[model samples]
Target: MKTLIVIPTYNEGSTIERVLNTTLEAIEGDILVVDDNSSDATKELVRNFFDTGRVFMLERPSKLGLGTAYIYGFRWGLSRGYDLFFEMDADNSHNPAALPWFLKELRGGYDVVVGSRYLHHTISVVGWDFKRLLLSKFGNWYAATLLGLKQFTDLTSGYRCYTSKALKAIGLEKIKSNGYAFQIEMVYRSHRKGLKVAEMPIIFYERGGGGSKMSRKIVREAMALPFKLRLEAIRHIFKDNI
Candidate 1:
C-alpha cells in the first residue's frame, strides 16, 4: 500500500531534523511536511529533504490552524493516490518506529488506528506532569461519555493512521474544527458513521525543545463541546436520527 506521513510544523527547528530523519527511518512510507511558513529555518531544512523524493513540503501562506494543515496534507495525499495516511507530530513526542503496528492493524481491516498510551503498561509515557496527565485522561473520559464513543482511549493524540477509504468516507469538506478539537471531531464523526476504529499503545513524550502552544483559550473552546454537541444532538433528535 502507498502510505504518506503528513507532519505539520511551525517553528519546530530544534527537533524537526531529528524527528524527520528518525521518522523516515522508522516508517517505510513517503513523507510530507506541511509547514506553516515558520519564521525559523524549518522550511529550508525540509526543502533539502523534498529534493530527494522521499520527502515533500507545502508552504502555506501563513500560520493557519492545525486542522487546516492536516486538511491540506490529506488532500495532497489523496490527490497522489496514497492508500494510507498518518497524522504525526513534528516534534519527537510520537514514536515513528511504532507506526508499523498501526499499519498492521489497518491492513488487517481496521479503518482508523490510534496509538493509545494507556492501552498497556509496556508503553507508558516517559515524562509527564501529574496535571497534564489528569487533563488528558479527563478529556478522553469526558469525550467518550459525552459522544457515546467506545474502545479508543486517546482522543487528542495526533499519532494516528487513516486508511484512504476511511479518509474518503470522512470527507475533508465536511470537517469543521480548526484546532485541537479537530482530532476529537474527526473520531466522533467516524464513530457516528459506523467506521471501525482501533487503538494501539505507544509512548508519547512531552516536548522538550519548543514551548507548548496550549493556552486558556484552547481549554475554553474545548470545554464548549458539551453545549455544542448537545445542540447538534437536538437537531438529530428532531430529525429522528442519532
Candidate 2:
C-alpha cells in the first residue's frame, strides 16, 4: 500500500523535529505535516525535511482544531490516491518506533489499527502521574461504555492507522468532534460502519516539550460527544426502519 502519515501540529517546535526524524527512519511511508498556522517554528522545522522528497506540508490559515487538521490531510491523501493513512501527534509521546507495527496490522487486513496505551488490561503509559493516569482510564471507560465500544481498550488513543477503505467508509465530512472526542468518534463510526478495528499495545510517553493542549473546553466536548454520536446512530436507525 502507498502509505501517508499525517501528523497534526500546532506549537510543537521543540519536539516536532525529533518526531519527524524518527518517523522518517521508522517507516517507508511519506509524511504530510498538517500545521494549523503554528505561531512558533513548527512549520519551519517540518519544512526543513522537504528536500527529502517524502515530506510534505499543508498550512492552514489559523489555529484550527485537531480534527480539521486531520480531515484536511485525509482529503489530500485521498485525492492523490494514497492507500493507507496515519494519525500521529507532533509530541514525542506517540513513539515513531511503533509505526511499523501499525503498518503491519493494517497490511494484515485490519481496517483500523489503534495504538493503545491500555490494551488487554495492561497500562503501558509512562511519565503520567497517578491523577492523570486515573483520568485517562476513567475517560476511556466512560467513552467506551456510553458509545457501546467497550471492546476497544483505548477509545481516545490518538496514535492509529487507517486503511483508505476504512477512511472512505466512515464519511469523514460528517465527523464533527474537534478534540480528543475525534478519536472516539472515528472508532465509533468505524464500528457502526462495520469496519474491522484492531488494537495494538504501545507505550505512550508524556510529551518531552511544549505545553499540554488539554483544556476544560476540550474535556467538556469529549464528555458530550459520545452521547451525541449515540443519538445520531439512533436517529439513523429510526430513519432506516421508517
Candidate 3:
C-alpha cells in the first residue's frame, strides 16, 4: 500500500533533518513536512531532500496550530491517493522504528492504530518528570471517561496511523481542535463513527532538541475540549429525537 508520513514542524531545525533521515531508512514511503513558517532554517533543511521525489514540504505563512498542520497534510496526502497516513512528531520523541508495526496493524484491518506510551504495565515514557507524567496520565483518563472512550489507553497520543477511508469517515475538514486536544478529538470521532481502533505499545522519548510547544493556552484548550465535544453530542441526540 502507498503510505505517507505527515510530520508537522515549527522551529524544529535541530532535529527535523535527523528525524526525516531516520524515517526514510526505516520505512519505504513518501514523507511530507508541513512547516509552519519556521524561522530556524527548518524549511531549507527539508528542501534538500525534495529533489529525491520521496520527500516534500508544505510551507505555511506563520505559526499555526498542530491540528491544522495535520489536517492540511491529510488533505494533501488524500489528493495524491495515499492509502495510509501516519501522524508522527518532528522531534525524535516518536520512534520511526515503530512504523512497521503500525503498518502491519493497518494492513491487518484496523482502521486506526495508536502508539501508546502507557499501554503496558510499566510506563513506556522516558525523560518525563513526575509532574508531567501525572498530568499526562490524568489527562488521558479524564478524556476517556468523559468521552466514553474507555477502550483507549492513550487518547492524547500523537503517534498514530489512519487509513484514508477512516479519515474520510471522520470528516477531516470539520476537525477544529488543535494541540493535544486534537489527538483526543480524532479518536473520539473515530469511535463515534464505530471505526475499529487499536493501540500498540511504544516508548516515547522527550525531544532532544527544540523546546516544547505546550503552553497555558494549549492546556486550557485541551482541558475544555472534552466537555465541549460531549455537549455537542448531547445536542445532536436531542435534535434527532425532536
Global lDDT of each candidate: 0.83, 0.92, 0.93
Candidate 3 has its poorest 10 consecutive residues by lDDT at 117-126
- For model 3, state the Cα shift of residue 108 in Å: 2.6
Error of 1 at 77 (Å): 1.0
Better of 1 and 3 by lDDT: 3
Worst 10-residue lDDT window for candidate 1 reads 117-126
> Candidate 2's residue-wise lDDT over 1-242, tens digit each?
79999999989999999999999999998999999889999999999999999999999999789998999999999999999999999999998999998877776778999999998789999899999999899999999998878899998999999998999999998999988899989999999899999999999998999988888888899999988987888899999999
Model 3 regions more than 4 Å off: none
Rank list by lDDT: 3, 2, 1
Each candidate structure's TM-score, on Cα atoms with residue i matched to residue i, is 0.93, 0.98, 0.98
**Candidate 2: pairs in clash:** none
Show pairs that collide, candidate 1.
Answer: none
Query: Per-residue lDDT of 133-175 in model 1, one digit per residue for the tens?
Result: 8888877778777777646678778899998888888778877
Candidate 3 lDDT, 104-176, residue by residue in tens = 8877789999999988666899999999999999999888988888878999999999999999999987688
Residue 72 in candidate 1 has what lDDT? 95
